[model samples]
Target: MANHLDLEEQEQLDQFKHFWKQYGNAITWVLIAVLGSFAAWNGYQWWSKRQAEQASAMYEEVERLIGTGDLVASTRAFDDMKQRFPSVFYTQQSGLNLAKAAYLSGKPDVAKTALTWVAGSKADTGLAALAKVRHAGLLIESKEFDEAGKLLSTDFPSEFGGLVADKRGDLALSQGKSDDAAQRFNEALKLLPQQDQYRRLVEVKLAALGSTEAK
Candidate 1:
């Protein structure tokens, strides 16, 4: 009876060994792939958190520099921060601030550069669309009529239709197309919600343009 038990145990061990020999490498690799992916995911989350913290600190520094009203120093600091973390939320916001600062400082070229960078970013599509709209306005101010027209004609998301139409009207006005401008502004009025203060602003523009309906 003992000999019979030994034979049975040996047979089971042999069967297991055969099975392992046939699939050991594939099983090992599958486990490694699964575990490796989990580890990589955790590492990426940690890295992203660290980067965001660093970027937030850098953005605060840039804000301090801007607040000092030292345009040259602020611009340099902003440049450095953007180079390091172009896709970070803080970096994107800093770009918008820099654009406003530069434009207000009569540095349209620098402002355009900042706005262009923000507009091109894919990290935040909503911010990017806002940047594009602002950039189009600046281009119009610069009398880059063709470029402004092209930018204003963008197929913006539905939520931004009113803003886009308003911009298009501005572009038309810049090009001396008053009738077209009125049409676009009226379109904006229809697209914009009644409660949106921006819609009131558009109404003002339409009134100024003598759109009878806007009256």
Candidate 2:
């Protein structure tokens, strides 16, 4: 009985060896691929988390600089944010906010610079359209009518139809085309929701045009 048991054990060992010889390389490669992919995924998760954390901290600093009313410093910080964290949401947000603050603070040049950056790259579709609109407004302020016309003519999301029409009206008005401006503002009124506060502003523009049709 002892000898029989030994023979059975040896036969099982031999079978295992044969299986290993047939499939060992294939199993080893499969395991390596799976482990390598898992490691890469984990590493990417860690790296993304670290990048977001750093970007959030920098955005806070940009906000602090803006609050201090030091636009020069704020612009510098925003530039740094854009350079280092271009893919981060905070970078685009900071650029938009900084541009608005700078424009309101009587620094249109700085606003234009920031707007140019945001509009040029187009990170988010909606935001990029907004940047172009505001940038076009600034160009109108500078009486660069042709350039503003070009910017405003680009494709915008469907939701931004009213805004684009309003800007087109403004551009037309700036060029002393009251008839065209009135037509554009009328188009804006149609595109805008009845309850939208912006419709009121467009109404004002129409009224100012003294177009009896608007009444």
Candidate 3:
């Protein structure tokens, strides 16, 4: 009986060895790939967290400068944020804020540069649409009618359609096309939500057109 048991144990060991010899290398490589991917994912998470934290701190500084009414300092801080954290949400936000501040400070050139950057950037689509609308308005103010028209002609997100229509009205009005301006303003009013305050402004513009036919 002892010899029989010994032979059975030997047979089991031989089968295990044969299985290992066939699949050992494949199993090892599979484990290595899975472990490598897990480690890479963990490293990426840590790196992204660190980047956001640093970007948030820099953005706070930019906001603080802006709050103090120091346009120059705010602009510099925004530049720094752009350089260091260009892909961050804060950088995109700073671009918008900086454009407004620059415009209010009588720096139309600076405002245009910032607005152009934001409009053309890979930021959120909605934010980019907002930038394009505001940039078009500035161009219209400068009497760059053709350029403003081109910008407004680009496809905007659905929520921005009303705003884009309003800008087109402004463009037409600038070109002294009162009939076309009234039509565009009516289109804008129709697209805008009834409760939107901007709809009231569009209504005011339509009223100013004096036709009373545009709804």
Candidate 4:
């Protein structure tokens, strides 16, 4: 009976050895892949967080320059932030702020360049749409009527429909198309929320165009 028990234990040990020989390499590779992916994921998360923190610091510097009314310094800081962290949210925001500052500083060319960059970038869609609208306004100021029209014609967020219509009205009015301007302004009025101050401005435009029903 003792010999039989020894043989039974040996048989069990041999079966375990056979199983390891058959599947040990595949199991080892599977574990290695899972562990590698987890390590990679952790590394990516850490890297992304570090990048965001650094970009945030740069954005604060840009904001400080803007607050000091130093357009040149603000632009330089923004450029640095974009170069280093182009995919960051703060970088896109810096572009918008820089464009505004450039425009107000009588640097329409700089403003347009920044705005165009934001508009064409893979930033947030709403921010991109806003940049396009602002760029269109600058184009209108420069009498680039066709280009402004094209920018306004691009698809925007639903919330921007009214603003886009108003821009179209401005373009039409600039081109001496009063009827079209009035129609577009009326469309803007319909699309705008009741409490929107911009709606009042559109109403004024419609009134100027001999449309008494803009209220």
Candidate with best TM-score? 1
Q: Rank candidates, TM-score, best first.
A: 1, 3, 4, 2
Provide C-alpha RMSD values for all models, in order. Answer: 1.7, 3.2, 2.3, 2.4
lDDT string, candidate 3, 82-179, tens digits: 78877777777888988998899899888888888788777578778999999999999999998998999898999998999999999999999999
- lDDT over C-alpha atoms for residue 177 of model 2: 95
lDDT of 1 by residue, 60-106 (tens): 99888878877788789888987888888888888888888888888
lDDT of 2 at 33: 99
* TM-score, predicted candidate 3 vs. hidden true structure: 0.87
- Assess candidate 4 and give its lDDT: 0.89
For model 4, name the residue pairs that clash: none
**Residue 152, candidate 2: alpha-carbon lDDT:** 91
The candidate, 2 or 4, that scores higher on lDDT is 4
Q: Can you write out model 2's per-residue Cα lDDT over 124-206, one digit (the tens) per residue?
A: 77787889899999999999998999999898899899899999999999999999999999888888877789888888888
Query: Predictions ranked by lDDT, top down?
Result: 4, 2, 3, 1
Better of 3 and 4 by lDDT: 4
Which parts of model 1 are misplaced by more than 4 Å?
213-215
Q: Number of clashes in model 1?
A: 0
**Candidate with maximal lDDT:** 4
